[model samples]
Target: MKKSLLTLGAILSLAVISCKKSESGNKSVIKTDSTATIVTDTDGKIDSVSQSSSTVDVNGKKYEKTDFVYKATDGTLVKVVFKNDPKESTVAITSNKKTFTLPKAETKGDETIYKKDDMTARVKGDSLHLEQGDNIIELKRTKI
Candidate 1:
C-alpha cells in the first residue's frame, strides 16, 4: 500500500509540474505579444517603428531592414510607418520599385489589417502576416 501511495504521489507531482510549465509557456507568449507597443519619444514623435525579423532575398543576397522601409525578394518595396495613432498607421507595398502610398490601416481588435486589391497585410503581436492570393508570408519581430 505504501508503494502504491508513493507512486500516486509521484504521478500527481509530475502532473502539477507539467501544468505549471505549460501555463508559464502560455504566459510568455502573451507577454511577448503585448510588449511590442508603439514607441514614442517625449516630443510625441514615433521613435522607432516595430518591425518583424522577416528577410527577403533579392537576387542571390538576403536583405533585412531595420528601418520603416525595405525591398522584398521580388523587388517589391514595402514600407511601414507609424502615424501616432494606432489606427492611422500605414503599410505600403508596391512592385516594380514604384513609389506609392497606401491608405491608413484599419484596426480590428489588436491587429491592423491593410487590404489593397488582392493583397492583405495584417500587423499584430509583433508579427506581420502578408497574404496575396495563395501566397502567405509571416514575419516575426526582430529582437533588440
Candidate 2:
C-alpha cells in the first residue's frame, strides 16, 4: 500500500511540473511604455525620471507614477514627473532649466491643476499648460 501511494505522489508531481512548463512556454516578455531620462534642473536637483510607470520606489514603497516628456513650442523638452502619495499628488515640472514641485491645488472636471508660489500647471489629456510669473508655457506630450 505504501509503495502504491509513493508512486502516485511521484506521478502527480511530474504532471504538475510539466503543466507549469507548458504554461510558461508561451509567456512573452512585456516592456514598459515609460523610459527614464535623468536630467538636472536649475536648482541642482536630480530627477531620475522613474524607470517604469508601474514600478517606482517612493520613500521605500512602491507607488504608481508616470514621467512625461513634452515638446515645447520652441522644440525644447519639458520633463514632468508625477508622484502620488496617500493623501495628495505632486508634480515636478522641469522646463527652461528651472524646476518646481507643485502640490495638488484642485481638480476641475477633467483637468487637474497644481500650483506652487508663482508657478501653475494645468494638465488636460495630453496637454500640459504651465504658467510662471509672466511667461506661459504650452506643451504636448511626445514619445521619448
Candidate 3:
C-alpha cells in the first residue's frame, strides 16, 4: 500500500508539471482594427495630436504605433504629419530602410515622434502589418 501511494503521488506531480509547461508554451494572440482621426488648427489654438495602440505581433515581431493623430503638449499633430506610406510599400516581416517624421507646419506646434527602435513596438509572428500606418485600432481587416 505504501509503494502504491508513492507511485500515485509521483504520477500526479508529473501531470501537474506537464500542464504548466504547456500553458507557458502557448502565446497570446491579439487582434485589432480601428480608425483614428484628428484635425488641428494653426496658431496656439491646438498644440498636439497623437494616438497609438498596444504591443501587437506583426510578421512575427511585436510592434505598436500611435493612432492617426498623436498630439503633442503644444497642441500639435507633430507625430502624425504623414498619414500613409506614399511609396505604397508592402508590410512584411523584413524591415525597410524608410523612415518618416511629422510634416513641418508653419505654425508654432509640436511634432509627432515615432520610436522605431522600441523592440516591444516591433512587428512579429506569421501575421503581417499593412501600410497606411494604421495600426490595429479595431478587430477588423482592410480589403487587401
Q: Name the best candidate (by lDDT).
A: 2
Q: In model 1, where do residues sit more than 4 Å from their true spots?
A: 1-79, 84-89, 93-101
Question: Per-residue lDDT tens digits of candidate 2, residues 26-126?
Answer: 45867558665565545678744333354567688666666778888999987888888676799888877888899989999989999998989999867
Model 3 superposed RMSD (Cα): 17.1
- Model 3 spans > 4 angstroms off: 20-30, 33-144
lDDT of 2: 0.79
Order of models, best TM-score first: 2, 1, 3
For residues 33-134, could you state the per-residue lDDT of candidate 1 as single tens digits? 444546564578765544543445667665543345444455444555433322344455543565434444578888888777777788775566778799
Q: Least accurate stretch of 10 residues (summed lDDT) in model 3? A: 119-128
TM-score to true structure, per model = 0.39, 0.57, 0.20
Model 2 spans > 4 angstroms off = 1-51, 56-62
Please give the ranking of all candidate structures by lDDT, highest first, separated by commas.
2, 1, 3
Give Cα distance to truth, residue 45, candidate 2, Å.
35
Model 3 clashing-pair count: 42
lDDT of 2 at 138: 92
Question: What C-alpha RMSD separates each model from the true structure?
Answer: 15.6, 15.3, 17.1
Report lDDT per candidate. 0.58, 0.79, 0.34
